[model samples]
Target: MRTAYSVEMVRAAERELMARLPDGVLMQRAAAGLAAACADVLGRVYGRRVVLLVGSGDNGADALYAGARLARRGAGVTAVLLAPDRTHPEALAALRRAGGRTVPGADAEEPLRRADLVVDGIVGIGGTGGLRPDAAALVDVIGETRAAVVAVDLPSGVEADTGEVHGSAVRADLTVTFGAHKPGLLVDPAREYAGSVRLVDIGLAFPGEAELEALQHADVARLLPVPAAESDKYRRGVVGIAAGSSRYPGAAVLAVAGALRGGAGAVRYVGPAGDAVLARFPETLVSTGTPEQAGRVQAWVVGPGAGDDADAVAAVLGTDVPVLVDADGLRLADRDAVRARRAPTLLTPHAGEAAALLGVAREEVEGARLRAVRELAERYAATVLLKGSTTLVASPGDGPVRVNPTGTGWLATAGSGDVLSGLAGSLLAAGLDALDAGSVGAYLHGLAGRRAADGAPVGAHDVAEAVREAWRDVTD
Candidate 1:
């Protein structure tokens, strides 16, 4: 698993570590790592034209010290000092001693135009909102240069704790983060600006849990269900899917398709699209009656092109088994009934659906996904899977929220979420908690989407079909 800590937590850890080390030792360690990474990006330090964007913070000192290292290696380094008077005195002296020259931010264009690489140290973890106007101008100039950009710690102008980018920010080809990952580096908006990330350990120890966690292959593999040798169909688990309407029978077919591929022993589907589902998958136990008459099931998946089937949504929510709500179900299901349930409930919604639930604009949810998802989980007193470029799973607690790292833009296709609903529901039936089920299901679903699309367009059925491959890939 990959973990990210908040700015306050990182600062506390850094301060404790700095107290134990000699003066300037920690900064040297960071500079060394930054210089090494810059060398790698340049391929050869000798005769390279490197430009450093230096600010009035420790990050600027880091850049100056790193530039000194490169200068000693025979690179022609120039520092574009945004705050000449406030720049680190010792760091500037070190750079000058190593033959690195400094140019004011106003005179940066000439050096920037001829640079082979540009290192962004304009802002650090303490920065918020966006870049200052003077700094913003330099970023604009840097954009015109054909240099490969490397940002120190994180891209300038993004919120380290919240991943929000309010205004103009430096977009780097690569970001060299120190000690630990920041929430902004792992989440989107800011994540998009940070093209690629490389972590450099400076030996800062963090005590408590991370603010956010992203599951990798090994973590998902551990969560997946593998039936025991003596386990029968009933012993394994059964997932009940109540979905589809005459208007959208394909939703039911797609949901059942994903459920069949999941680790469930059997899939019992109840909806008006029974005949369509039966045609696609004859093995499914079909019923036209309410979910109450669907016999026994370990978990239930409601919604997914359900139209306005309020009765069906109500009936599924009332069940004692764990239930997942999605699509039309999100609109039809009652919040009080959902909050009133003792059994676990999982709510899956895209940005638009989530906006509707929270009674806000879709842009608001998209802009602040972490806050939105957390608010939804707390309000409903249930787990929420906010589906998008980065799928987030948050339960009704202060625990670290799980972020799914896998996925492609191709997943934006229709009926894709319906498949996810069934897959997660099956995991719930297999006994994984709402958090684990939602994250793992998203992980697999994303990998399957990538495999099925492979740079081309693919249908929802293709993604569902590729889940088996994703499962095997993880297990192996």
Candidate 2:
């Protein structure tokens, strides 16, 4: 897993390292790592012109020290100190000793325009709101230049804790962050500003808990369900799916389509459209009774297309196993009853359903997906998977929200959600927790959808058929 700490945690970690090491040791290490990355980008540092956009604070110091390194290596280095008097004294002295000169004003724009590369050190973690007037003007000049930009720490002006961009920030081609990753580097809005991220270990030991994390392929591979040699159909896990009606029998087929590919041992279908479900996948066991009468199941998936079926919703929720609620189930839910349930509940809602649950408008939910997912999790006291362009899964208790980065717009077909619910419910039955189950299911679903579409418009059945291929890719 790729772990991300909050800004406060990063500061605390830096302080702890600073106290133990010699004065300026951490900054030296950061600068050395940064300079090495710059050298790699410049190919041969000798005879190359480099411009550093200096601001006040340690971020500027990092740039100044890096410039000194490049100057000593035969590069033509210059620092444009935005705050001349406030520039880091030690860094300025070192730069001057290495034959680097300081230029004044946006007049330094000419040097930047002529430079081979630009180092954006305008703001750091201490920065608040947006760019100052002078800084914004400098950024405008830098943007007009053709030099590749490398940002120190995060791209300036982005919220380190959340991924929100309050004001204009530099868009860097490469961002070199010290110690560990920040939330903004992994999330949207701000992530868009950070083209690519590189982490430099300054040997800072952080003993505190992480606030956010992004799961890598290896992490997802480990969490996937694998059957044992002694395993049987019942031992593997049974997933009960209660979905569809006469009005929407396709929902039942789509949901079952997803369930059959899930690593679950068996899929039990219950509802009015059992015939439709069985017709698509003969492997599924069909039942005409309620979800409770569908016999014992490790997990239950409710509410894909049971339109206004109060009895169906109640029967599914009445069970004590892990439950996944989606679509019509979201609207017909009794909030109090859902909260009062003993089993783990996973709520999957698109923008419209999420709006109704949060008592906000759909636009509000879509505008800020991170906030919407968190709000839904906190309000329902359940794991929430807010489906959209960027699908987010958050649990009320703790941990960083899991963002699905593998989906395409082509997945927006009819009955696609039903497949997701079934896949997630299967993972739950396979004994994964609500958060892991939801995130893993989304990862697999997205991979499947991508394979099924392959740059063409695909139906729900194609997505269902592609799940096996996606599973193979993950397990292999």
Candidate 3:
């Protein structure tokens, strides 16, 4: 897993390491790593014109020291000190000792435009709101320049803890971060500003508290359930799906289409569209009554195009099995009813449905997906998978929120969500917890969607068909 440490946790880790090391050792390590990355980007650091946008804190110190390294290697380095008086004294002296020159504000623009590369050191984890007036002006100048910009630590003015952009932030072509990854480096808004992130280890070990995290292929592959040699159909797990109506029989087919390939031992279909589901997948155990009448199942997938079928929804919600609620089911769900369930509950809602659950506007949910997913998990007391361009799975407990790295725009086709709900519910049935089921399901679904389309348009059935291939990619 790719872990993200919060600013507070990073600070504590820095403090602990600082106490054990020499003064400025951590900063020097950070600077050296940053300088090497900069040199790689510049191809040949010697004879290159580099401009360092220095702020008032240790972030500026990092840039100044890195600039000094480049200067000693034959690059012409100039530092534009935003706060000269408050600038790091040792770092400033180091830069001068290495043949680096400082230019006042009035002389900054020309040098910045003419430089081959620019280093942004405007803010670090200690930064509050957006760029100050002077910093904004400097950023605007950098924005207009043709030089590639590299940000020290994170892109300035981004919320390291939440991935929220405070105000106007510098858009760096590359960001060299220290210690560990920040939430902003992986999530959106801030992620858009942070182009490519490279982590520089400063030997600061964080024992606890990871604010954000992204699951790697290995992590997902490990968490995915696989059948043993002695496992039989009944011994593995059965997933019961309650979905579709006469008006939307295709939803049931699509849901079953996904459930069949979800590593489940068996799939039980309980709804009005039993014939439709049977037509699609003859292996599925089709039932004509409510979800309760479908007998025992390890998990349940509820609310995919059931229309206004409150009775079926209630029956599914009433079950003691782990349940994944999605699509139209999100609209009819009672927050208290979901909360009262004995088994683990997983909610999969697109931005619009998530907004309804939160009683907020869709724009609000989309604007801050991280906050919305967390709030939804907290409000309903269940794991929530907020699906969109970037699928996020949030649990109410501690640890980093999961951001799915595998997704394509093609996954937004009709009935795609039903497939996802069924897949996740099947995983839950196969004994994965709510969070793992949702995230793994989403990851596979996205990969399947991409493979199904292959840059062209594909219907929901194609995505379902590609699940096996996606699974192979993960498992193999």
Candidate 4:
């Protein structure tokens, strides 16, 4: 699994390492890594034109030092110092000795326009808000240039902690980060600015825990609910899906399709679309009654095109078994009912549904997905899986938030989320906690979506069928 440390955690690690080392040793190590990454990007560094956007912090100092290295290797490096007087004196002298020159931020247009590469050192983790007026103008100049931009640590004007990009920010084709991954580089808004990222180890020790975690194949494989020789249909687990209506019978079919592949022994679908579900997946035990009368189930997936059936959603929530609420369920379920549940509750919401829950604008939820999910999780005292380009799972507890890395744009199609709810609920039935079930389910669903689409448009059914392939690939 890949992990991201918070700024505070990173700084503490850096400080501890720096205290043990000789003065300037850590910075040199960082600069050496930064320079190497830049060299790789440029391919041919000799006689190449490189522009550096230098600020007042250590990030700027690292850029200056890296530029000095590039200058010594025969690159024509020019540092555009945003705060000239506050620049690192030692780094400035080192750059000049290595045959590099400086340009004021005011007269940066010419050098930036003619550059083959640009290095962004304007803001690091310490800085807050968006770009300053002068820096914003310089970013505009960088945009007009054909230079391949590389940011140090993080792109300027991005919320390093939250991945929130406000106003103007530097957009880099590559970012060479030091120590460990920041939350911004792995998330959206800030993630979009950082095109491709390379982590340069500076020998700083990270904490055992980080602010965020992204699971890989090995992690997901371990979390998957594989059956034993002794396991039977009832012993494995049953997933009850309370979904669809006569008007939207496909929802029940789609949910059942997903639940069948979710490692559950049986799928007991209780809804108005029993005939529809049986038509598609005959293995599903269809029920036309309420969730309470649907016999025994290890877990319940409530509301996906159930229309205005709030009573069904309430009944499912009242059950002692783990429950996953999505779609019309998110719209109809009472907040108090969700909070009062003694069993594990997982809420799956898209940006619009999340907005309704938070009483905020859709743009607000979309822009700050991390905050919205965490807030919702804390408020509801449950696990929240915010479904979008980047699927995030956050619980009300102290563990690191899980950010799913496997997703494709084609997943934006209709009924995709309905498939996800059933899959995760089935995982919950198979004995994974809310966090594990949601995170693992998302990982598989995204990979399945990718395999199903393969650069073409795929229906939700195709995506559901591909889950078995995704599971095989993971286990293999």
Q: Which residue ranges in model 1 land beyond 4 Å of their true spot?
A: none
lDDT against the true structure, each candidate? 0.94, 0.87, 0.90, 0.93
Could you tell me the TM-score of candidate 1?
0.98
Per-residue lDDT over 1-476 for candidate 3, one digit per residue giving the tens place of the 0 to 100 score: 88888899999999999999999889999999999999999999889999999988889999999999999999999999888899999999999999999987667999999999999987878786777887888878888989999999998888787777766889999999999998878777778899999999999898886877688789889988899999988777999999998999999999998988887899999888988888879999998877887878999998998999888778888888899999888888888999898799999999999998899999888767889899999899989999997788998877568888887888889999999988898999999999899999999999999999999998999999999999999888
| True lDDT of residue 141, candidate 2 | 80
Lowest-scoring 10 consecutive residues by lDDT in candidate 1?
186-195
Candidate 4 C-alpha lDDT tens digits along 386-446: 9987889999977799999998999999999889988999999999999999999999999
Clashing residue pairs in candidate 3 (N, C-alpha, C atoms within 3 angstroms): none
The TM-score measured for candidate 3 stands at: 0.94
What would the per-residue lDDT of candidate 1 be over residues 70-141, giving only the tens digit for each residue?
999999999999999999999999999999999998999999999999999999999987899999988898
The residue pairs in collision within model 4 are none
1 against 2, candidate with superior lDDT: 1
